[model samples]
Target: MGVIQLPSPPRILCFSFHILLILLQQTTAERELKFVVVVFRHGDRTPIVNFPTDLHKETEWPQGFGQLTKIGMQQLFELGQYTKERYSNFLNRTYSRQEFYLQSTDYDRTIMSALSYLSGLFPPSSSQIWNPGLLWQPIPVHILQKSSKQKLHFPLRDCPRFDELQNETQTSPEFQNRIQPYMDFLQTMAVNTGLELNHLKMLDNFQLWNTYDTLHCEDIHNYTLPVWATKDVINKMEKLAELSLLSLFGLYRREEKSRLQGGVLLNTILNSIKQAANSSKQGKMEVYSAHDTTIGALQIALNIFNGKLPPYAACQFFELYQESSGRYSIEMHYRNDSSKDPYVLTLPGCTSSCPLEKFAELVSPVITENWSKECGKQDKMKDIFLGFDVAVGLLCIFNLVLLYLLYHYGRCRRRNNYQDI
Candidate 1:
């Protein structure tokens, strides 16, 4: 090598050094994770509502109906622990007002899940330990007071336009086409399960999911399943339920439906991201402990729904990173199964790490700025009614004028004839 090595050319060495410098700069730019938004479905829980024929009753659960179970708490705790490990470098070692925020839907399971998750995420340290006996410390899990206007969750009720959109979705060709294949099975299920097929909307996928969940949970606990609860039946029900879910927030009038259901949450997330970009007052990480419906709706809005129902404790992550070039990008990852690594999700028109500006532009179509005003429920009906009333009034006036003219002409003719006689 020494005999073959003539001194390297000065220009070549300088060019190589310049290339190395540029790469170092690029590596530095990729180091920072500026913000994070983690949205997770609440962990395993007792069925919210069970079928009438089910053997399991509300009394069997210690917290009664729709409450989080010990298993759910443990699931969330594990999720929080995983989150802590992933963000150990980005997030502060111990919880602080500036470093973390947690929110949950206004329900017993979701609120409790948020609290349980917090317990694992921020185990008290020596400096902040209020009670030496316990490793947990109180962390705020905020919730909006339940009202007619609940904007934080998906499938929000009390929105007249949302209900109208849902009705429209149900009647769309897509919905009909999807349901046609399942009609006979659903009809039989209805008769056998004491539901009315004519009132199918009342027993939509969410309701079917309740029945399936009760059975699944019972089976897990060694409770006997009915003869009809075969694997094929369960899988079919699951598929149809997934389709019904898609119709609720996707298909046909997807954008409008998203505006009414998932878009509100999207807007919240966007605003949080924007705020995080500009301000330090807000926390670096925002966590939402919500329901499967919430996750499904959000995924549908994002156009990343994988057609299967999100499992218990499934998580979706939105991470904001700043590159060495001083530009920010947003990366999305979905963790639907605990056993597998989270899947990296790219926006349709962008890469896995989509620039912040580009990400916002792509998502703008689904973000409803003012949800109520955008809904515009009564305006169309009012316009149609007003037009109808004006048309009727014009018709009445024309008829009246025609009758007067005819009467006048008849009188004139009669007078002329009498004068001639």
Candidate 2:
């Protein structure tokens, strides 16, 4: 009681001091961000569809189905320039073989887009140039084999659950409401094009998707879409394509799907960042060259779609900055519209710059398979018991057969002994 007779400071002052200390701690924690990961859709591409009656069907395009157009290359190049400007501080003035890792799905358009982007992003700096004419430097762009379904690619690895989700999306009340207007638009399209409603449904098929992609590419490159297709129709068709991306990702209908594709990509980026932060060496930027589907899926996953599709040259940028206090922060920038400054992304509990570890933790639930739900409780143990029972029954049958053979042999031997006697 005597020792506590005098309170050192007022309770309000003490509380204020604690609050200030906490703020300082938070500020210190916020300073240590150090990695960047980016996943983006490929720039502009030719149409992936062409009507049967159209004069410039598949025959007009050189290397068929969903190839990148000249405009697509230009779009990626512009994107590269933008990237160079955005990360000028973190990245070396010149592109270094050691500093960057680029990967793409094994698709012609994606591969080409990645190459084009590299050309623009790392245009020969004054010091690195071997010849003035050669603006291109060799940078390794890794391609995942088409068969490696594990690696990130569009129309995500076929899972029955995802397929069911897609079906549900098609039939969902919200989707039905959204598509009702589009259905009316389809009827008009059918009347104008002399195609039946049934045939119009065929437009949703893979072949039709391919035709649309090819034509879209051609239009972008040379201002040549079918004459029957008016600017308004073309715009609508483009929106439909964007919608297709959202559908393919299954993000619009199911929150879980968003976590798998987009969330996984985010987690991967954060993991890379965490690794970079712990290391003494400066981390390299990660680049992904993929389809509009890839971008759409990712954006839907991140809940960042501005209700407009990402254009041919659209890019998403993730930057990790290390503060003077040795803390890290993350900032996401989207360059869907090249005309405007990139839009920043902010997640709850994290600022534009979030810690890598926290980011990974946040997305963990999405990537991890819910085994109990995926494999039903009843079916889970059925297979194990069924297999064990079958094995044991087979063993018992074999032993019984062996005993019978032994008994018969003994009887036969005794008969032979009696004959000898």
Candidate 3:
């Protein structure tokens, strides 16, 4: 005590400085996120198509089929506000032209939804240099077109492997088990409607697609659907559509296609992260505006199927930050509504702040073709065989029906001759 009492000013000064340095470092770390990636579903709209019995048809929608509605615009605007608040610390006080980028699948509704969302996210601030009368300034929104066969937007590309995956899904034991309940429900619907289960128009995938498209068109035109298709039916149909996307992406087989698509998207994300890890420039955020199908497909790929369609404005966000140890970690958040907080996701064996390299490795199997090679050519051939079997079965049934009719006619002719004799 006596030794310490000899006025240790140097020691006191050093200790105070050290404490201040620690506080400064903590503050910097808290505010030092460098990059963000967000993928989102497009906002609401009239049904893309209608059913056979729809009362209000495609012509009723002012913009024609598949256009966003006024309410959709409002929903996206609110979503933009939520995004702004959630990332306020990482984002600039006001959006900077240089700090953000956007991309959308090439479709009117998707592109327009992105535009609408940005309008609310970065509304004009005092520092904005727009012409006095302008409501907003232009931001660059990129689009990817001709990347695949189907032009219907994200989750609609015609991949042969994806088709094979869908076939595998139907035959998979797990899928049959999961869908047995729904099949029972469909049978109940058929009984109530006095429709034969086989004759039920909604049984086939294309028929379901047509029904949805027709409903979409009708909703746009302000036409009404049949009593049988109450709001609940429409909602259920939407869920089925979302499940179809998962089927295509192999979500049902977590060890297979989910790994591939998830790996592909994950690889793209990791590459973006590594590119940003060393950069000292103001960090950037990339937003992808797309459809529910796209969100569903990606979710299946990631083993995150939640058993419902992602709402029109649902979003998945990825943030990258650096730790004091000089390693980078990633955090993922999902926002499905304007009023709710985002939910966090941590990879297996990783904390909420996961190392970038580890994250890449965890999902590497998804993007590489090595796993597909293991499935072998037989899986592909099985798909072809199953398709032909269904086609030939239908032809045989048709021929049988035709022959039965002819036999009945000949029997009636012979009966009439005997009566004349």
The numbered model that scores best in TM-score is 1
Query: What lDDT does candidate 3 reach at residue 404?
Result: 100
TM-score for candidate 1: 0.82
Predicted candidate 2 versus true structure: per-residue lDDT over 1-421, tens digit per residue:
3555555579778988999999999876766435567676786665656665555656666767577777778888888887888778667888876788899989888999899988888988787788888888877889978787345675555455665666677666655665666787777766655556655443324433444555556665574556767778877766666566666565345457765565556556666777777776755788888766667666666666665667677777777778766666667788778799978877555667666566656556556454234422345478899999999999999999999999999999999999999
All candidates: TM-score:
0.82, 0.76, 0.72
Q: What stretches of model 1 exceed 4 Å from their correct place? A: 1-3, 6-30, 148-150, 201-205, 377-421
Give the candidates in order of TM-score, highest first. Answer: 1, 2, 3
* Location of the lowest summed lDDT over 10 successive residues in candidate 2: 368-377
**RMSD, candidate 1, Å:** 7.7
- Please write out the lDDT profile of model 3 over residues 134-184, one tens digit for every residue: 767677788868474222244333344655666677777756665565676
Better of 1 and 3 by TM-score: 1
Candidate 2 accuracy as lDDT: 0.69
Number of backbone collisions per candidate, in order?
2, 34, 17
